[model samples]
Target: MAEQVQVFGFWESPFSRRVELALKLKGVEYQYFEEDLPHNKSDLLLKYNPIHKKVPVLLHHGKPIAESLVILEYIDDVWKENYPILPHHPHQRALARFWAKFIDDKVVVAVVKAAGSRGEDREKAIKEAREALETLEKEIEKSNKLFGGDDIGFVDIVGTVIAGWIPAIEECFGFQLLTTDNFPNLIKWSDQVVNHSIVNQILPPKTEIVAFMKANWKF
Candidate 1:
């Protein structure tokens, strides 16, 4: 019998979107539940991910997997032959994991701080974030397509914020965090990632995301 799959997620969360995209790319049929976060997190979410009490919890055959990156690996492992979200080679896989971690640990903080902080703090954050983006642009410049070379892989899923969320944040703030002139390769990659059918289908509309950010993201 096929295992039942369900994901508790939030509509505007890039982390939750990562798991959604991973499962969709793998052609896995699963149920999705949008959690009300930071206010009314569901009991199921608490039960599944007591440590984080976060969304994007993947429930497979009654087993719970928390953390977007961990859930991504789980999806890839369980449906290994279906789509292969991570590379098979050990070295390449390690690099993918490294970049994914970088995005989570470094890039995200810089970007969010740049977009959400006040005057001087925002300026400093933008500088830091630009440096990070420039480094990523150089990495992408070496590849003909995605960071994974020919296809979307681990890094791509973790970088979901750039494809949709960043743009919405920029719109809400009336400032450009990413642009062709500043980082061409990353912009191109973002377009490709967002335009990919699997990703595009699941992306929350830009207007919705902008409204959400305007209401919640303080400047």
Candidate 2:
């Protein structure tokens, strides 16, 4: 029997997009279900992910996997015949996982805080965000092409927020964080990732993202 693959996701969420991008990279044919989010979450999502009750849940052969990062690793492991998302060497794979965690715990958190806060808080958040991004910039500078080397991989997948969502968030909230002068390496990587044939197809339109942020985000 053919494998049954399904993804529960939200349209504007970078986390959700991460799962989609990984599956696409592996050339996996999966059904995508968009959740209503912040209002009417599907019962299936809650049933699958009782802890977080969030989108981007991966269901493979009726077994549900929650969390984007976990789903990414799972996808790569299951579909080893296709593109490898994580590095082959154990140490390199460890490094990729480390960087992916850093992107989430540090970079994503700082960027969200910077975009959402106000006054002194906003200034502090922006400072932290820049520092986080600067650290990432230095890391990316070490890569020949992308964090994953020649192709998109785990760290790059985890960094979809940097490539796709941050710009929209910045524009929607009228703030300037990531810039060419500040992060040339990151800017170059972002351009490559966002415009990459596969990734470009999955990313949501900037206009739609901005509109959604205006309507849903607290700001």
Q: Which candidate is the best by TM-score?
A: 2
Instruction: Count the clashes in each prediction.
Output: 0, 0
Clashing pairs in 1: none
> What TM-score against the true fold does each predicted structure earn?
0.95, 0.97
What lDDT does model 1 reach? 0.86
lDDT of 1 by residue, 1-219 (tens): 235999999999999999999988888888888898658999999999999888889999999999998999999999989888898999989989998988887778898887778789888987887788788888889885998677888898898877788788778876676888988889999999998888898889999999888787666
TM-score of 1: 0.95
Q: What TM-score does candidate 2 get on C-alpha atoms?
A: 0.97
Q: What is the C-alpha lDDT of each candidate?
A: 0.86, 0.91
Backbone clash tally (model 2): 0
